[model samples]
Target chain A: MRAAIPTLFILVLMILAVSLLGVFGSPLLLRVVIGAMINLVVVIGLSIFIGNSGVLSFGHASFAAIGAYSAAWFTLPITMKKIFLPSLPAFVLSTQVGLAGGAAIGAVTAAITAAVIGVVIVRLSGIAASIATLAWLAIVHSVFSNAEALTKGTSSLVGLPIETNLFVATSAALLALVVAFVFRFSRYGLMLQASREDEAAALASGIPVRQLRLFAFVVSAAVVAIAGVLKGHFLGILAVGQFYLEFTFLSLAMLVLGGMRSLSGAVVGTFAVAAIGEILRILSSGFEIFGVEVIAMPGLREIGLAIMMLLILLVRPMGITNGRELTLPWKRKAANELPITNDQIG
Target chain B: MNFALQTAIDALSVGSIYALSALGIGLLFGIMRLINFAQSEFVTIGIYILMLSAGVWFPLAALAAICVVVVLALVVERMAFRPIRTADPATLLVTSFAVSYLLQYSLVLIFGARPIGLDILPELARPIVMGSVRVPRIDIATIGATIVLLSAFALFLRKTRIGIEMRAAAVDFRMARLLGIRANRVIAVAFAMSGLLAAVVAILFAARTGVAAPTIGLELALVGFVATVIGGMGSLVGAVFGGLAVGVVTVLLQAFLPPELRAYREAFVYIVVIAVLVLRPQGLFRGAAARERV
Candidate 1:
């Protein structure tokens, strides 16, 4: 558990910085930081499974979708539900819970969905497994977008209480960080990392690859689900498209940019991408920097970010941190303790 | 009988387009173990070229599109991929995704995100009536194009030295390299072939949809990726079969499911995909190349 200290300390400091920004920054900045925090939660959740198991998942956002919709189902006012989702089941129509209760419901729903779906998913590996997860995302998107009564189909489900303030988002991020950190050092995590390095060897050593992958899948899904609930509440609305391709790509890019093999990579990657994205967004709006007028072009932001990501990957293929956790210099080479190497980072 | 014929033709047309795209993905996967998500961008560029060169003679315009896309594919390989050619499969995939995003937004910058109609191949829109069934000419063209391409590709693989070398490289790159097969040349040839296939898909797709957009090829490439996976990665024949299966299932679901559930047709199709994977985790093909060494 002592190994967890440095990782937790670094994460806590990051969270404190965000909290300070929320307290002192302008409302617009507050909004940006809150959105970034939500995305951070999702990326952290993504790294837990993708980093540890070395599997690419394109479907984690589906759990986020599940969480958002279910949270909306449980929390939306009965009057609003009757107007927007008249065909919802009577139980859901009648249900109206507070934000915490709804988040619980959302997380549980996503966890159960993942547990059922992960059986087939964890059995496969490499690109095949990646494609399977993509298929699952499609399945979820199709169902959620088509289930008009439950999800309002393509329309936005509104009236979610805008209760996910900076405090809530920061707390959730902290929780995600703690959960991920704990899981990374757990037995299941170590086994999954072994399998990730060399599946045949890991299996030869009698590691339950499938089971560990399943556990990671479920755990990550729950974390992402919580982020989804946070996002829905933050936006005061839920839309199927919000949890689809764009969100998946953005979160995955952040994880890969930070480094996919370590918790610190996830956190640093999210902050870096979010900060760059914000600066790009501002520049795209025709900001004047250094007395040189930057022309307004909405498309330039995406292109610029994509180019940056490409350049970064070309320069540092393993990511910014290169899969190593950030540890204090004075604590280096403490012989008996885990040194937070790439192999032990996840 | 008429409805059955129409559905069959529809399925065939869609299946052909997907198969063409999947062949591109499978070819690259065969050589580099890289799933080129940017294949979609290649298709999109081809469509854009076709749209812009509308005033030119149709055959010449098509050739131009093919040439441009092939060149673009080669450039992308050298600039974006070749540098990190030895990276792990996941890293390779993420890089391709970045390239795809870059290409897509660049298209958006060139031609705004909004889709524009393309009037190329207007003649293919005409319908041919046969025994109480109306078959669109484009459907026939798509199916014919796919058949010709597949046969020609098979012949090339069987009869040519480069094709044989490509096959050997795909089967075992290290051993093939040790045996004097040039890795760079084989990989480049694979990218060129995939580019050619993407070009063909772009024309057919444009003719069918009558529109050009930055996102037109994204969905196509995604379907191709899924088909490549279900067909068994690195197995060319399996990719075709997978595309056919996905297309048929999609058409059948849209035709038969209740209107309320019809919108969930994609869900049903993917459910079948999951089922296929569970039954055969390696995919439908048991190719020696796809099997795990252990």
Candidate 2:
């Protein structure tokens, strides 16, 4: 009964969002909504590892990149894809599968890469882990940038079918949210959090810390791959640089700004930041200040984002949602009766 | 042989700059256990300062640039870092990232998106011809400066009472406090020293490339970071050796690889870094137990 509230609310929200997209029918708004939804998947995926395992990963975007290129390579029209994969398998060449197949393949590829890299990376803890993950990001970036035959090098690969509509994106986000929530409540999540909070104690309690981290890392990579597939389709293009430092930073910012530990926080943070970013773009196009032409406001979005991040860090470091999910009144009533300890709250 | 020698010299020059940059990053991490993502911005800040003060005497401009970076570092420490020193390391990491983005975009706001070339001293920028091979004078200067700064830094850590205290604090802040070492003062000094190293690297990097962009620091920071990891995280001497090794490997890859595949140099270097890390997670050199001071 307690879990039913969130599921109902999510269903309503998803229906309402799709209805709005259908009613408005503006390509730009559709793109923005789809982009936000896709980002929700990635952010929630990151939450599994970063939020639960308490290890920061700077290389998640690399998995996203792998997912993106993989999908593009498999799905794009063979004639248009001649720039990258000239000699493709007839199966990949003749048949263009739906978004699900593309996304699934992307997830598998990213998961495999993460599994290989996580073996070494998950062994390190704290700042060392952070640095090692960054190294992984750099390594992946170099590979994508140089592998012209596969990624079309730095050039934008065009001609992806515009298959990622409101339905696909919303479905992916819902799936990601469900998965993330399930993980959050499971024993695996509890053990990962315990390890994060007190590694030695958790180890003393017989938890295989490395194995748990590796599990979270692989799962996160797979989920983020779905996000990457959606983003590629939404944009109708893929570039190596798009998946590099800039997107990595943006995704990290969203996770941090949204409460890292909560599924709802991931959703809210993605929409909020996406809206903020879009508004900044609009303002930079139209508004002016102190006789300065605002349309040419260089790096305005980044500056605004930085300021927002700084304010959030200073004022409410736990994030806007603080890991609390918004649910139906009945759930709230039930939750009120429970003597909630601080341990269960955050 | 000449090509190999030239590559070796070029590697040494680049390695020296990386070593300088990594020294700052390594020292900061050693003391606070906080990876300041904003350290790259300090390098960018120093370069911008140098560019702005180009009309002045070169040495004076350099000094002013270092001072500016030191002051900026102190401000960041006070405003961003000090408040969150007791928080989780993740919080500090995120805050440092915010600071980095803030600095990068602020520069973008002020300077626009164009890359600016620093007007380095002509003598420093000129190439020093030697037999069949020629190396830039800035390379020589970078090597010299790195050696002097590292030596001075080692001496500071060994001979000075404050240095001892800072080392002690780094080992364990609570224990250092129990022993009456001022942790705040030690951390501040680390920031200042980090700033100073950033300034030195900035000058050398700008002189070598003749261009300065806000984004350049991120790449240099990556190299420094890899080197720091390859060198034991807390060991200063290890950072130097790791920096040199990374530089040599990158140069050797470029020299040996076919022209068509030369662009893969960085990728190869990253692979090497990953392999080294997997083989020796603790790094090549682990420092002996040092008293915690900072």
Model 2 alpha-carbon miss at residue A241, Å: 0.7
Return the top candidate by lDDT: 1
Question: What is candidate 1's TM-score for chain A?
Answer: 0.94
Clash counts per candidate, in order, are: 0, 9
lDDT of 1 by residue, B146-179 (tens): 9999999999998999999988877777778889
Model 2: lDDT to the true structure: 0.78
Report the lDDT of model 2 for residue B243: 83
Model 2 vs. true fold: TM = 0.90
> Each model's DockQ?
0.57, 0.44
| Model 1 spans > 4 angstroms off | A288-292, A330-346
lDDT of 2 by residue, A1-346 (tens): 3464574377348535743764486777777777777887888888888987878898899999999888887778767766557766657766666677899899999999999999988878765677688888888888888887777778888888878888887788788877776776577877887787677888889999999999999999999988888889888888888887778767877887776655566776777788787777777665768987656568777877777777776776666666555566567544222221232100
Chain B global fold similarity (TM-score) for predicted model 2 against the true chain B: 0.94
Stretch of 10 with least lDDT, candidate 1 chain B: B285-294
How far is B50's C-alpha from truth in model 1 (Å)? 1.6
